[model samples]
Target: MLHGIDLRLPRGRWTAVVGPNGAGKTTLLKALAHLLPHEGSVRLLGREAAAWRPRERARALAWLGQAEAGAEDLLARDVVMLGRLPHQDWLGVPSPADHAAVDAAMSETQCQAWRDRALGQLSGGERQRVLLARALAVGAPLLLMDEPLAHLDPPHQADWIALVRRHVARGGTAVSVLHEISLALQADDVLVLQAGRLLHHGPSRDPATHRALEAVFDHRIAVHAVGSQFVALPQLQLGSDSNSLATSPSED
Candidate 1:
């Protein structure tokens, strides 16, 4: 149901897609990853993504979906090592390079201590990090993450942002669908969606981007400049009832 939803994510940068629920944010990511059927063309690294083999596409761009699950009995590090499968032949054992990549991914994600833990036993946040580590282990130049920060604490969320920055610094590209406008502001670019349409797509610094975001949500949300940071906050939309303050507890 997306319309005119073209996006260009520059290499060595992070782009955050933000929007209300059911705005086709996840659908857009799926389409770009060739996980879902869509009408328009989707290109990765200057070639049509659909033309690539499954293993080739998986190698070129690793996607960390919002609700990902792996074998419950598998160890965390083993799961991360699974990312290297595309580079190996069927029934191939883990090579030294695979081990090195898995170790690096675990260290980067601070999951080294849980390397031997079963995936099913980890907490939600821990599992989320483990999945991200798996994605990182693939060593793909392009990464797509949907709601990657969900269930993460503030510190881990910050760490994830720093990790993304490091990845981009190494000539990688990342596209993430995020709900937190404040955290998303840290990305180099932003794509705002509304009603399955591309409301705006450009640098995060653009005032028009903020305006489109505010307008798309019908001003029920307000975008304000707090120092150098742009924050989107829920604003009360008052009804005609004089006895009620329009704001709900959640809005406040």
Candidate 2:
């Protein structure tokens, strides 16, 4: 059970959810998107999130899950086109509008060149871009992604970051659950979680935010400003001679 997760994501900005494993970061995103049931108020676009219709909610909020699972045998473009399912008729034929949206999504994610390739044949990074294209096809105002950078190369990961920036630049809102602290620092806002509770939620530049982030991951990690970016490094632990000798085997 997550307790005290009262976070407010600002409009037209990117917010990164950071925490150690089992910190409820994924759960928090799911709950905010109404993909998971939870207690407390969750307002999306000034409406109580729970009150929105399933179809309406889907078109208003897009979700890219950790695995992006489904019909792996499908072609990359077909998988991307699946994002249009929310807007299709009972027959689900792609309308001209649908095609335009799909084209735009593919172009934005840079997957247009690989549109005809089978999803299974794509590299891990390629598949992630395709999945992002699928999410963008929804054309939602709010996008929630869980580990969207999984299996991506540095260049593609940077591409994903740029895509997110473009989306938010165009009046979209995004919340992502990410483990990469360095990339997370690029977001406009940060939400730190620890043991199913909110550790801090505010602008990423706040000193308190950095301190709380450092504390939650333990003092072992330090957050420092490098140029205009904040990066985290793992601190080394020193062992005392007494403790080391105590574990030595007894002499025969």
Candidate 3:
């Protein structure tokens, strides 16, 4: 349902896609990953995403969706090994490089401890970490993630941010759909969508970006700087007279 949405995500940067529910944030990510058909063009690595060969696209970009369903019987390590499919030969044997990539990805995601465990046996958060590891194992220059923070606790969320930061530092690109405003603000740039259209796209620190965010949410949320970081808090609309304000309405 996206219309006239034209934007370029720079390389070596982390861009977060954010908006209210049903704003087409997930749709935008899917479009970028070529999972959905659209009228306009989506270029990745100097070529149209739709024009790339399937195996070539897989090697150039990795996708992690919100709910990734797979065989429950597979071990965590084996699941991660799937990311290396594009690089493997017809025999599909795991090369030393593939093993190293999987090990590094699992270690970075803090899921190495559960490498031998079955996916069905892992907790939701643990499964999320393993999926993240699988995405990382792809070793793609561009990573597109939708709601990657789902089922993650605070510490693990921070770890995810760190991982993305490191990836960008190494000249990789990351585009993610995140509901957590504070976490989204940590990214280098922000793309705000509203009702399947582009509302704003700019650096996270720009005042205009914050204003657009507030406007889209009906000003019920306020972005504030907590020390060096910006945090989004619910705006309290209460009467001036304390006694008159018996109840306060909160917006999400």
Candidate 4:
């Protein structure tokens, strides 16, 4: 449902795609990953996305999807191993490098404690950490994630931010479709979308970026400086008799 969209994401930088419900943020992400049929051109690492072989493209780009299915029966560690399939040969056994990468990823995500457990046996947050570890184990130069913080608590959410920061600092690129506007503001840049169109794309700290963010949500939210960092907070306040403000449910 996207229209007239053309953008060259910044190399080696983090950009968070954000918008209200049905703004096409997830659709745009899937299109960039070449996971959806689209009419526009998408370039990856100076080459057309369609030009690369499937395995080669998988090696270059890692994707973590929202509400992805059918991993419940796999053990936690085995689920992470799926990321190494692109680098492994057909019917090949896990190599030492693969083992090391998996270990490191698990350690980074703090999910090594339950490596033996099935995905369905873990809590939502634990499963998310394992999935994130799987994505990281791919060792790809570009990472795309959708709603990565869905089940994470605040502390782990901070950890995820630091993890992405480390990834970008190591010369990799990151793109995430984030629902948490405050968390999205932490990215280096922000791409604001509304009604399947681009409203603005710029540095997260830019005044114009803040304005576009506010506008997309109908000014129900406001960007404010809180202790030297930009944060998006709710502008709508409930009356003294009201329990809380009502909000419409969000969707892709």
Using TM-score as the measure, which candidate wins? 4
Once fitted onto the true fold, the runs of candidate 3 whose alpha carbons sit more than 4 angstroms away are 238-252
What lDDT does candidate 2 reach at residue 29?
Answer: 88
**Residue-wise C-alpha lDDT for candidate 3, range 1-252, written one tens digit per residue:** 798899989999999999888899989999999999888789989998888999999999999998899889999999999999999987778999999999999999999999999999999999999999999999999999999999999999999999999999999999999988889999999999999999999999888999988898888788998898888777776678865633323221
What are the lDDT figures for the candidates, one per model?
Answer: 0.88, 0.86, 0.91, 0.92
- 122, model 2: CA deviation in Å? 1.8
- What C-alpha lDDT, on a 0 to 100 scale, does residue 106 get in candidate 2? 95
Local distance difference test, candidate 1: 0.88
lDDT of 4 by residue, 139-234 (tens): 999999999998999999999999999999999999999999988999999999888899899999999999999888888788999997999877
Runs of candidate 4 exceeding 4 Å displacement? 237-252
Clash pairs detected, candidate 1: none
Best by lDDT: 4
Alpha-carbon shift of residue 158 in model 4 (angstroms): 0.1
Candidates ranked, most accurate by lDDT first: 4, 3, 1, 2
Considering lDDT, which of the candidate structures 1 and 2 is the better prediction for this target? 1
Clashing pairs in 3: none
